[model samples]
Target chain A: MRLPSLIREVWANLLKKPATVKYPFEKLPLSKTYRGKHELMRDRCVGCGLCAKICPAFAITMRSVYGKVSPEVDLAKCIFCYQCEDVCPRGAIKRGKEYELASWSRNEMIVR
Target chain B: MEALRKAEENFVVLKAFNDLVLDVVSKDLCTKCGMCVSSCQVHAISMTDEGPKSVGPCRQCEACYYGCPRSPATSEELLKASLSSEKKDDILGSYNKIVSARTVLSEVKSVAQDGGVVTTLLIYALEEGLIDGGIVASKSTIEAWKPVPKVALSINDVLEAAGTKYSNCPSLVALKDALYGYDLSKVCVVGVPCQVTAARNVKVQPKAARKIGDKIAFIIGLFCMESFPHVKLAQFLTSNGIDIAKVSKFDIKEGKFRVYMGDAEVLSVPIRNLKDYANRFCETCRDLTSWYADVSVGAIGSGRDWSTVIVRSDEGAKLFDGAVQNGYLEVKDIESDGIESLRKIAKRKASKN
Candidate 1:
């Protein structure tokens, strides 16, 4: 309502650093607990298929990799809930902070 | 004697898995007892929710066909092999003694369905070196109240598997795991009547079941009127406004299907109303008392918190006496009225089915 208060507020905001970063150049730091891409530890996996069974989006499918059964996640369909990591009896599945998942081909969206 | 001769003649013709599919499975006479799957030496068969299916090439060994309970090729022979006795009753089958018994253990009684006799005997057998492991139906970790056949090796595992699951569980399928996976020389099997018949058939088949059957130390059969399909039973319970996961126990008593949650009755429906959910193949089953089992136990013809046990074989009588002498169980003679009621129910099931 007052012109002096408005001018003071604008001056203070001008002195403060910007809250955003440039696109594709400077990126914001991700939190340590951020959930993004899935990483499966092949050696630790027991092939129980519990992750595939508990996946609400049906994104995980069990496939034989290197003669041992493991989960292949379809990142395109994943909800990034980290439920697979939670339900795995062996701590095999982990969530990584790699949110830039845009790809030219759909086949690239799968995480083996 | 004539029927036994006929069964032998039938056994002379080797039947394969395809014959089982054609005669029992396709005709809806398969009890889903998992005998064929367990009897397959080559591991060609796997159990599905629909029934047993061939996952690998058939070896044509005829194990699956002859081992099936529905196949008439081995029924009479299996009965004679398991209970070679002269005295037999039309309703109760051949038994050494019929008694009313209850377990004295408080831990087992708290979680058991009726008298905890099954769990008590299993504990006794495991601790007494009679059996290294027992195959029982334990609750599934992923589903509520769904029975999954398991190999319980320890007393804790046996205690965890206590209580009755009113769903069709292919319990004999776990026999392979109990023998091979757990590497147990002596194992016990607990199952329903159809499963008992399957086990007996497995025991009598000399070629395929010789290794597996020899490891089976005892069989405990529970009286089953009929087992409900899991999906349909869950649907029925959900439709009745009961949360499936919250249910702690299920019981069929006094003509009612009761559901309980921690000492509180949550739902009660007439058993007749659940006819639609009963397994279609159960109606063709005639052995209500598991006539081929070593020991048969049921809630019928017994008071509250008690089980009516029928010791069918000499081994069964020995096991019963051992449990009683070890102070794990309390025994009393079943009343004549109790026997009459049990016979009436058994006859009704035999005639109605």
Candidate 2:
């Protein structure tokens, strides 16, 4: 291609609409595999504690009373690395895409 | 000057005008379902009639779709057949006959996770020289699922393992460790059905079969439908504004976890939400009672504060009988209706994938 034509194409491209999503303003559709927020179904939780054991970050904790299972996670310590979601054989702790996680204070970062 | 001005106009003005025109003409595909409205964690997303509109320019955060169940739903609900069968009287009698001869409830219930029957029984075995150590779930820290196969030497340790952990715990690997790593001659391990089966499969720890693996003197199985992922439980507590640090108690009853925040019933979370976090492995499981275990301990069809224990082997019956004889346990022959309920529950759970 000629240099003049290439430069013209480049200029035209620059003037065209950018492919970047406005993000929060213009949200991008999440990919099918995007891992984001963690959700727990209370009734189904048998408190077996496999999720915490497999978590490399050790961010999860199991709580209980009268022998029932209860678990908690600290989002501040989480790296958003979805290892916990993958090893969960029950698919209990799944990744959700709501990724806006900024906070004015350190406490806000603490999920649990 | 005019030529320079024209050149400047050519570079910036035309492009800016074109962008504005394109922006206005473009079709906004945002569906104003208010799904994003409820999904946003920071109130960042709002819906307008003219397609879901964004108010403040987004901070590039994508919290809207992550927690939304409708936006590319991550899970599927399917119909499946059950895998369990009724517990035969012969099987029950055999197990009771064995456990009742060997152990007591005082030792089991005092230190166990919930009712303490399992732990107490295990302790009696260890103390009575029936076994070396009781392999049970032991809490390493307050923040993680209790690791299974933790050998408890004292009554306190046994009590720690007595509770019901409805979440899928990998501590079942402790069985593998017991057979391979620890040179135990006889080990009393507690687990779910899968772990019991795995333990029974091992004949020798090494390839040469040089070291005979430990015999599972007692296999106390917990009844489980499915276990939740630990992270989901934690997130639910926090999202509901419950202080995790201050949480003193957590109970699952009537399909709800009545979370107590400093002695106050702050939240009653539906058990269905907790079910969403269950481990996927449970779907394929067919045995509600570890059929191979010496005895299974769970609350599937029992009244509160009592565990429905199904003794499967002779060894289990002996221990249970012994515990009762020694006045350490209180035994009420399970009613026929209760037994039927348990069987129904087991059959249903076994079939669900």
Error of 1 at B272 (Å): 1.5
- Estimated TM-score per prediction? 0.72, 0.50
lDDT string, candidate 1, B1-353, tens digits: 99999778755444678888998899998888887877776678999988899998875656678678787676575566568555588777888888999999989988887889999999999999999999999999999989999999999999999989999898888987876577687899999999988777666654334446667889899898889988988999889888888998899888799999888998888888898889999878777888888999999999898899999887887788999999999999897798998888899888888
lDDT string, candidate 1, A1-112, tens digits: 6999999999999999988879699988899789988887776565656678778999999998655678999999999988777555344677888899999888999998
DockQ of each: 0.01, 0.01
Off by over 4 Å in 1: A1-112, B1-13, B206-208
Which pairs of residues collide in candidate 1? none
Q: For residue B54, give model 2's deviation from the true position in Å.
A: 48
Clashes of each: 0, 80
Q: What TM-score applies to chain A of candidate 1? A: 0.92
Q: Alpha carbon lDDT of residue B184, candidate 1?
A: 80
lDDT tens digits, residue span B53-126, model 2: 45544322232332221222212121001112234442122234211121245445333434556766776677
